[model samples]
Target: MDENNNLTEPNDSQRNFILAIYILFALSVVFTSVTSAVGAILAYRKRDDVRGTIYETHIAYLLRTFIIALIGIILGIILSAIGFGLIIIVLVEIWYLFRVVVGIVKFAKKQPVTPTGYFM
Candidate 1:
């Protein structure tokens, strides 16, 4: 019984981490840069815990999404000085929404995100 409980604890913690990722992603849509950064940090901190498990893919997906989004935002800001960043920022926002929605859907269905080697 004690062994069974020990096994379940890790599963529960993993599930909580997954849930936290989803919530942070959702919050990022509303709070923008702040929550997105927080989400990325959370994923980074929890990465080791999920290694070799299904959630590892999620961490990778989220980490990549966060990095790309940050880059896009920075580029957008820089280009805005030249009047091109508005479009880039808008596109990046859409991409963020799409990634979050897809991630949530896959998570809901309890399926692993297929490794695409790039942002999906």
Candidate 2:
């Protein structure tokens, strides 16, 4: 409502949402596959806010990575069972790192960057 407020950075809620999503992304590799789904659900439920949208995008990216890893793991298991699927897992890990770096940059600068694609 005031000029000061208008010029201020994103409020607490927005920051929290982005932080939570970042946490989830960082933990995705360490946690079980189901964790991605849980994060996605949280993002969707809180979709009314800017933070929520960022989380939603984060969730989508995690979900995609999870699915890709799952497939790679399964294929590796079936094909060789010698750990060939670790490649996919490694790729996802790199992607997570990239996302986090970009996220931090955007958040720190107070830029309105959407984690999700055009649909969000």
Candidate 3:
């Protein structure tokens, strides 16, 4: 409550950021890798602004997801030369999609992500 005893609502910027992240993730699933990179960059840029807030966990979750997906895809490509990379690539893609969908669902429900581990 402010001096007027009115309840102060949360700012819209946080919600905007969350929605942007979800859109970017969905784009990544439908389009190319560029969207994922953009999302990761946005998360990094906004990390400080959300620090010490609940949104910070979401930011961290996104960063970890992006980095892990990138690394896994690269490794999958390299290992494909050995005939085993095909499996790795498929698994990595599935994992990435699962994380994005789960995150979006949780965010939409206004629920805090439990565990918040490196993985989904």
Best by lDDT: 1
Question: Compared with the true structure, what per-residue lDDT tens digits does model 1 show for residues 8-116?
Answer: 2237689788878878888978876787788889999988898766677778888888888889989999999999999999999898888888888877775556545
Query: TM-score-based ranking, best first?
Result: 1, 3, 2
Give stretches of model 3 more than 4 Å off: 1-10, 114-119
Residue 65 lDDT (model 2): 47
67, model 3: CA deviation in Å? Answer: 0.5
* TM-score (C-alpha) between model 2 and the true structure: 0.54
**Candidate that beats the other on TM-score, 1 or 2, i.e. the better one:** 1
For residues 1-120, could you state the per-residue lDDT of candidate 3 as single tens digits?
112223233257986897798789779888998998999899999888765555666677788888888999999999999999989989988888988887888777654453257555
Q: Provide TM-scores for the models.
A: 0.85, 0.54, 0.85
Q: What Cα-based lDDT does every candidate model obtain?
A: 0.78, 0.53, 0.76
Report the number of clashing residue pairs per model: 0, 0, 0
